[model samples]
Target: MAEGLFRFAAADLDDVEVSSAGIAAYGGDRVSPETLQILNERGVGLEGFRSRMVDEGIIQQATHIFCMTRSHLETLEALYPQACEKLYLVCEFAEIDGEVGRDVPDPIGGGRGAYEQVAACLDQAIAGIIGFLRGTGKGQAG
Candidate 1:
Protein backbone atom coordinates (compact mmCIF):
# COMPACT_ATOMS: atom_id res chain seq x y z
CA MET A 1 0.00 0.00 0.00
CA ALA A 2 2.99 2.26 0.52
CA GLU A 3 3.60 2.44 -3.22
CA GLY A 4 -0.05 3.22 -3.94
CA LEU A 5 -0.11 6.12 -1.48
CA PHE A 6 3.23 7.44 -2.60
CA ARG A 7 2.03 7.43 -6.17
CA PHE A 8 -1.31 9.00 -5.33
CA ALA A 9 0.46 11.68 -3.36
CA ALA A 10 3.02 12.19 -6.08
CA ALA A 11 3.10 15.71 -7.42
CA ASP A 12 2.36 14.81 -11.03
CA LEU A 13 -0.02 11.91 -10.54
CA ASP A 14 -3.77 12.09 -10.75
CA ASP A 15 -6.98 10.10 -10.26
CA VAL A 16 -6.04 8.14 -7.19
CA GLU A 17 -6.55 8.35 -3.43
CA VAL A 18 -4.52 5.89 -1.45
CA SER A 19 -4.91 4.71 2.13
CA SER A 20 -4.03 1.68 4.25
CA ALA A 21 -6.16 -0.50 6.48
CA GLY A 22 -5.94 -3.54 8.69
CA ILE A 23 -9.28 -5.34 9.02
CA ALA A 24 -8.68 -5.84 12.74
CA ALA A 25 -5.90 -3.54 13.59
CA TYR A 26 -4.68 -2.86 17.06
CA GLY A 27 -6.75 0.27 16.61
CA GLY A 28 -5.57 3.62 17.87
CA ASP A 29 -2.46 1.89 19.10
CA ARG A 30 1.15 2.61 18.31
CA VAL A 31 3.23 0.61 15.87
CA SER A 32 4.97 -2.40 17.32
CA PRO A 33 7.93 -1.62 19.60
CA GLU A 34 10.19 -3.88 17.60
CA THR A 35 8.92 -2.42 14.33
CA LEU A 36 9.76 1.06 15.56
CA GLN A 37 13.19 -0.04 16.63
CA ILE A 38 13.82 -1.56 13.26
CA LEU A 39 12.58 1.52 11.41
CA ASN A 40 14.74 3.68 13.65
CA GLU A 41 17.81 1.70 12.74
CA ARG A 42 17.00 2.46 9.11
CA GLY A 43 16.75 6.20 9.84
CA VAL A 44 12.97 6.30 9.51
CA GLY A 45 11.20 7.98 12.41
CA LEU A 46 7.57 6.97 12.86
CA GLU A 47 6.90 8.07 16.41
CA GLY A 48 4.02 10.26 15.33
CA PHE A 49 1.98 7.49 13.81
CA ARG A 50 -1.02 6.00 15.59
CA SER A 51 -2.41 2.81 14.08
CA ARG A 52 -5.94 3.18 12.73
CA MET A 53 -8.62 0.70 11.84
CA VAL A 54 -9.35 -0.32 8.25
CA ASP A 55 -13.03 0.42 8.12
CA GLU A 56 -15.62 0.82 5.41
CA GLY A 57 -14.87 4.50 5.29
CA ILE A 58 -11.29 3.84 4.34
CA ILE A 59 -12.34 1.32 1.72
CA GLN A 60 -14.85 3.76 0.36
CA GLN A 61 -12.17 6.41 -0.08
CA ALA A 62 -9.39 4.45 -1.71
CA THR A 63 -9.23 3.85 -5.46
CA HIS A 64 -6.52 1.22 -5.40
CA ILE A 65 -6.19 -0.75 -2.20
CA PHE A 66 -3.03 -2.64 -1.35
CA CYS A 67 -2.64 -5.16 1.44
CA MET A 68 0.33 -6.99 2.89
CA THR A 69 -1.10 -10.48 2.67
CA ARG A 70 -3.45 -12.79 0.82
CA SER A 71 -5.59 -13.41 3.86
CA HIS A 72 -6.07 -9.69 4.12
CA LEU A 73 -7.11 -9.43 0.48
CA GLU A 74 -9.44 -12.43 0.75
CA THR A 75 -11.00 -11.17 3.93
CA LEU A 76 -11.57 -7.75 2.46
CA GLU A 77 -12.81 -9.23 -0.81
CA ALA A 78 -15.30 -11.38 1.02
CA LEU A 79 -16.51 -8.59 3.25
CA TYR A 80 -16.44 -5.80 0.67
CA PRO A 81 -17.20 -7.38 -2.66
CA GLN A 82 -17.67 -4.08 -4.42
CA ALA A 83 -14.13 -3.07 -3.53
CA CYS A 84 -12.46 -6.32 -4.49
CA GLU A 85 -11.12 -5.00 -7.77
CA LYS A 86 -9.13 -2.38 -5.89
CA LEU A 87 -7.62 -4.83 -3.44
CA TYR A 88 -4.19 -6.32 -4.04
CA LEU A 89 -1.07 -7.59 -2.39
CA VAL A 90 1.70 -5.00 -2.66
CA CYS A 91 4.34 -7.61 -3.40
CA GLU A 92 2.26 -9.13 -6.14
CA PHE A 93 2.68 -6.04 -8.23
CA ALA A 94 6.40 -6.57 -8.58
CA GLU A 95 5.68 -9.49 -10.94
CA ILE A 96 8.38 -11.44 -9.18
CA ASP A 97 8.37 -15.24 -9.35
CA GLY A 98 4.67 -15.42 -10.09
CA GLU A 99 4.03 -13.91 -6.67
CA VAL A 100 1.18 -11.90 -8.14
CA GLY A 101 -1.19 -13.81 -5.83
CA ARG A 102 0.50 -13.90 -2.45
CA ASP A 103 1.01 -11.69 0.56
CA VAL A 104 3.70 -10.46 2.90
CA PRO A 105 3.84 -12.15 6.28
CA ASP A 106 3.29 -10.48 9.64
CA PRO A 107 5.98 -10.78 12.26
CA ILE A 108 4.52 -8.65 15.00
CA GLY A 109 4.55 -11.41 17.60
CA GLY A 110 7.96 -12.72 16.72
CA GLY A 111 11.41 -12.03 18.20
CA ARG A 112 13.80 -9.17 17.54
CA GLY A 113 15.50 -11.16 14.79
CA ALA A 114 12.18 -11.67 13.12
CA TYR A 115 11.61 -7.95 13.25
CA GLU A 116 14.92 -7.40 11.50
CA GLN A 117 14.06 -9.86 8.77
CA VAL A 118 10.65 -8.36 8.31
CA ALA A 119 12.07 -4.87 8.05
CA ALA A 120 14.57 -5.97 5.45
CA CYS A 121 11.88 -7.62 3.38
CA LEU A 122 9.58 -4.63 3.67
CA ASP A 123 12.33 -2.27 2.61
CA GLN A 124 13.14 -4.35 -0.44
CA ALA A 125 9.54 -4.80 -1.46
CA ILE A 126 8.54 -1.19 -0.91
CA ALA A 127 11.53 0.00 -2.89
CA GLY A 128 10.71 -2.31 -5.74
CA ILE A 129 7.05 -1.32 -5.72
CA ILE A 130 7.86 2.37 -5.74
CA GLY A 131 10.29 1.86 -8.55
CA PHE A 132 7.64 0.07 -10.54
CA LEU A 133 5.13 2.84 -9.95
CA ARG A 134 7.64 5.46 -10.99
CA GLY A 135 8.61 3.55 -14.08
CA THR A 136 4.95 3.29 -14.94
CA GLY A 137 4.73 7.09 -14.74
CA LYS A 138 2.74 7.10 -11.55
CA GLY A 139 5.15 9.18 -9.46
CA GLN A 140 8.54 10.71 -9.36
CA ALA A 141 10.95 10.80 -6.46
CA GLY A 142 10.18 13.50 -3.98
Candidate 2:
Protein backbone atom coordinates (compact mmCIF):
# COMPACT_ATOMS: atom_id res chain seq x y z
CA MET A 1 0.00 0.00 0.00
CA ALA A 2 2.81 2.41 0.89
CA GLU A 3 4.69 1.50 -2.27
CA GLY A 4 1.72 2.12 -4.53
CA LEU A 5 0.76 5.33 -2.74
CA PHE A 6 4.26 6.73 -2.78
CA ARG A 7 4.64 5.92 -6.45
CA PHE A 8 1.36 7.63 -7.18
CA ALA A 9 2.10 10.67 -5.03
CA ALA A 10 5.59 11.04 -6.39
CA ALA A 11 4.74 10.36 -10.02
CA ASP A 12 5.84 13.79 -11.17
CA LEU A 13 9.31 13.27 -9.78
CA ASP A 14 11.55 11.25 -12.08
CA ASP A 15 14.56 10.74 -9.84
CA VAL A 16 12.81 8.93 -7.04
CA GLU A 17 12.46 5.15 -7.00
CA VAL A 18 9.81 3.65 -4.73
CA SER A 19 9.65 0.00 -3.73
CA SER A 20 8.66 -2.06 -0.68
CA ALA A 21 10.00 -5.19 0.97
CA GLY A 22 8.95 -6.85 4.16
CA ILE A 23 11.16 -7.98 7.01
CA ALA A 24 9.31 -11.27 7.25
CA ALA A 25 7.94 -11.78 3.79
CA TYR A 26 8.01 -14.69 1.42
CA GLY A 27 8.99 -13.66 -2.04
CA GLY A 28 6.38 -14.06 -4.78
CA ASP A 29 3.35 -13.67 -2.53
CA ARG A 30 0.73 -11.47 -4.12
CA VAL A 31 -0.63 -8.38 -2.43
CA SER A 32 -3.87 -8.91 -0.54
CA PRO A 33 -7.12 -8.31 -2.42
CA GLU A 34 -8.16 -5.74 0.13
CA THR A 35 -5.01 -3.78 -0.57
CA LEU A 36 -5.67 -3.84 -4.30
CA GLN A 37 -9.20 -2.64 -3.77
CA ILE A 38 -8.15 0.27 -1.57
CA LEU A 39 -5.47 1.43 -3.96
CA ASN A 40 -7.70 0.97 -6.93
CA GLU A 41 -10.31 3.10 -5.25
CA ARG A 42 -7.66 5.80 -5.06
CA GLY A 43 -6.80 5.22 -8.74
CA VAL A 44 -3.46 3.70 -7.85
CA GLY A 45 -2.98 0.23 -9.23
CA LEU A 46 0.05 -1.87 -8.33
CA GLU A 47 -0.07 -4.28 -11.23
CA GLY A 48 2.35 -7.19 -11.13
CA PHE A 49 3.51 -6.30 -7.63
CA ARG A 50 4.78 -9.14 -5.50
CA SER A 51 6.20 -9.40 -2.02
CA ARG A 52 9.94 -9.48 -1.46
CA MET A 53 12.27 -9.83 1.48
CA VAL A 54 14.54 -7.00 2.31
CA ASP A 55 18.09 -7.63 1.09
CA GLU A 56 21.53 -6.06 1.21
CA GLY A 57 21.19 -4.79 -2.33
CA ILE A 58 17.97 -3.00 -1.50
CA ILE A 59 19.52 -1.53 1.63
CA GLN A 60 22.58 -0.33 -0.22
CA GLN A 61 20.57 1.30 -2.96
CA ALA A 62 18.06 3.11 -0.84
CA THR A 63 18.67 6.73 0.02
CA HIS A 64 15.88 6.70 2.61
CA ILE A 65 14.26 3.66 4.16
CA PHE A 66 10.97 4.15 5.96
CA CYS A 67 9.57 1.48 8.22
CA MET A 68 5.99 1.16 9.39
CA THR A 69 6.92 0.15 12.91
CA ARG A 70 9.72 0.53 15.39
CA SER A 71 10.20 -3.22 15.45
CA HIS A 72 10.86 -3.23 11.74
CA LEU A 73 13.31 -0.37 12.12
CA GLU A 74 15.11 -2.14 14.94
CA THR A 75 15.41 -5.31 12.89
CA LEU A 76 16.82 -3.40 9.96
CA GLU A 77 19.24 -1.61 12.23
CA ALA A 78 20.49 -4.87 13.68
CA LEU A 79 20.92 -6.39 10.24
CA TYR A 80 22.31 -3.35 8.50
CA PRO A 81 23.85 -1.05 11.02
CA GLN A 82 25.75 0.76 8.33
CA ALA A 83 22.54 2.06 6.82
CA CYS A 84 21.25 3.55 10.05
CA GLU A 85 21.64 7.04 8.72
CA LYS A 86 19.09 6.37 6.02
CA LEU A 87 16.44 4.68 8.09
CA TYR A 88 13.30 6.38 9.43
CA LEU A 89 9.81 5.80 10.69
CA VAL A 90 7.29 6.40 7.89
CA CYS A 91 5.55 9.02 9.98
CA GLU A 92 8.66 10.82 11.11
CA PHE A 93 7.68 13.75 8.99
CA ALA A 94 4.03 13.89 9.87
CA GLU A 95 1.75 13.99 12.87
CA ILE A 96 -1.21 11.62 12.84
CA ASP A 97 -4.20 12.46 15.07
CA GLY A 98 -2.25 15.18 16.89
CA GLU A 99 0.81 13.03 17.50
CA VAL A 100 4.08 12.35 15.77
CA GLY A 101 6.23 9.19 15.66
CA ARG A 102 3.31 6.81 15.62
CA ASP A 103 3.69 3.41 14.04
CA VAL A 104 1.53 2.86 11.03
CA PRO A 105 -0.91 0.20 12.09
CA ASP A 106 -0.60 -2.91 9.95
CA PRO A 107 -4.01 -3.78 8.56
CA ILE A 108 -3.26 -7.30 7.38
CA GLY A 109 -6.20 -9.67 7.90
CA GLY A 110 -8.08 -7.01 9.81
CA GLY A 111 -10.79 -6.55 7.11
CA ARG A 112 -11.60 -3.75 4.72
CA GLY A 113 -12.09 -1.07 7.34
CA ALA A 114 -8.62 -1.70 8.66
CA TYR A 115 -7.20 -1.46 5.17
CA GLU A 116 -9.02 1.80 4.53
CA GLN A 117 -7.65 3.30 7.71
CA VAL A 118 -4.15 2.32 6.78
CA ALA A 119 -4.56 3.75 3.30
CA ALA A 120 -5.66 7.05 4.79
CA CYS A 121 -2.66 7.04 7.10
CA LEU A 122 -0.31 6.29 4.25
CA ASP A 123 -1.92 9.00 2.17
CA GLN A 124 -1.03 11.61 4.76
CA ALA A 125 2.39 10.19 5.48
CA ILE A 126 3.27 9.92 1.82
CA ALA A 127 2.38 13.55 1.30
CA GLY A 128 4.61 14.52 4.19
CA ILE A 129 7.34 12.30 2.76
CA ILE A 130 7.13 14.09 -0.56
CA GLY A 131 7.34 17.40 1.19
CA PHE A 132 10.36 16.26 3.17
CA LEU A 133 12.09 14.97 0.06
CA ARG A 134 11.55 18.19 -1.81
CA GLY A 135 12.45 20.44 1.10
CA THR A 136 15.63 18.55 1.82
CA GLY A 137 16.56 18.45 -1.85
CA LYS A 138 16.65 14.67 -1.61
CA GLY A 139 14.06 13.86 -4.28
CA GLN A 140 16.05 15.37 -7.12
CA ALA A 141 19.14 14.24 -8.98
CA GLY A 142 22.34 15.81 -7.84
**What is the lDDT, from 0 to 100, of the residue 118 in candidate 1?**
56
Best by TM-score: 2
The list of candidate 1 runs beyond 4 A from truth reads 1-19, 95-101, 135-142
Cα lDDT over the full model 1: 0.61
lDDT of 1 by residue, 44-126 (tens): 65666666777777777776676777788889899889988666676754644455544566776778987676555555556
The regions of model 2 sitting more than 4 angstroms off are 139-142
| Candidate 2 residue lDDT tens string, 48-72 | 9999999998898888899998999
RMSD in order of candidates: 4.7, 2.2
What TM-score would every model get versus the actual structure? 0.74, 0.95
What lDDT score is found at residue 73 in candidate 1? 82
